[model samples]
Target: MYIITVEYVIDPGHMLTFMDAVLENAETSLHKEQGCVQFDVSQSHDNPTQFFLYEQFVDEVAFQQHVESEHYLTFSQKVQPAVVSKSVRHWYSC
Candidate 1:
């Protein structure tokens, strides 16, 4: 199994807009992607401008396909201006 976590730091003023975009992306993945086992988004209480996303895919290939998907590209383009910083971590089960 594979797991990934992505965090984004956005300008405080754009938090709401970014969250909306994230919600749209999450909905699309949940309904449309077969390999997407889990897709979740969370907000940091300590830092309102920060957001966390957790994703689980059947394997690396599945995750790669997700990255190349039209929905992902659209989300990335839509949120680029609002995002100030981002980080992604990948992990695998033993």
Candidate 2:
């Protein structure tokens, strides 16, 4: 399985708008993509500007395809101005 956690440091003022875009992307990925197993978004309890995304895919190829998808591209473009910084970590299950 391929799992990843993406962290987004967002500008506090744009939280709502950013969430809207990310949520749409998450829902679309989960419902429309056969390789997408899980796509979840969460806000930090202490810091509302920090967002976390937990995503699971069938494989690296599936993930690459997700990155190339139209919805994902739209989300990325829409949220760019709201984002302060972003980071991603890949996971391996034994």
* Cα TM-score per model: 0.94, 0.96
User: CA lDDT, every prediction?
Assistant: 0.91, 0.93
Q: For residue 30, give model 2's deviation from the true position in Å.
A: 0.4
Model 2, 1-94: lDDT tens digits are: 8998999999988988998999999999999899999999999999989999999999988999999999999999999999999999998656
Model 2 residue 45 lDDT? 95
Q: Candidate 2 at residue 59, lDDT?
A: 93
Off by over 4 Å in 1: none
lDDT score at residue 72, model 2, on the 0-100 scale: 93
What is the C-alpha lDDT profile of model 1 across 12-69, one tens digit per residue? 8787889999999988987888888999999899988889999998899989988999
Model 1 Cα displacement at 67 (Å)? 0.7
lDDT of 1: 0.91
Lowest lDDT 10-residue stretch of candidate 2: 85-94
**Candidate that would win on TM-score:** 2
Off by more than 4 A, model 2: none
